[model samples]
Target: MAKQQVISPLPGTFYRKSAPDQPSYKEEGDQVAVGETIGLVEVMKSFHEIKSDFAGTVTKFLIDNEDAVMAGQALVEIDG
Candidate 1:
């Protein structure tokens, strides 16, 4: 298996769940498909969906929920 990374497109606050009370969109060992939404980024009150470009199993999350992230930062690792 090869490892891949899901990157953030813009600088913002990363969120694993759609809302505070909801479960995370994805977790470690979860299967992910191409174009699957794994998280969200909030910037200036606007939210943007962060999608995976690779089809694989989610191996790890590099950033924690509600953490600040930068553009081009790796958010999650995928094993394919």
Candidate 2:
């Protein structure tokens, strides 16, 4: 298996859950499909879903929830 990285497409604050009380979209060891939403990035009062580019098991999250991120920043790692 090879490790694939999920990157942030825009600069924003990354959120693991849709809302404070909601469960995270994904977590470490979770199965992730291609085009699946792993998280959300909020910018300029708008939120965008961050999708996975590869199908695999989520190996780890590179940053914490609600953390500020930059475009092209690695958000998650997957093994496929």
Question: Against the true structure, what is each candidate's TM-score?
Answer: 0.98, 0.98
Off by over 4 Å in 1: none
lDDT of 2 by residue, 10-75 (tens): 999999999999999998999999999999999998999999999999999998999999999999
> On a 0 to 100 scale, what is the lDDT of residue 16 in model 2?
96
TM-score for candidate 2: 0.98
- Compute the lDDT of residue 51 as modeled in candidate 2: 94
How many residue pairs collide in each prediction? 0, 0
Model 2 pairs whose backbones collide: none
User: Which residue ranges in model 2 land beyond 4 Å of their true spot?
Assistant: none
Error of 1 at 10 (Å): 0.3
Candidates in order have lDDT scores of 0.97, 0.96
Candidate 2: give its CA RMSD in angstroms. 0.5
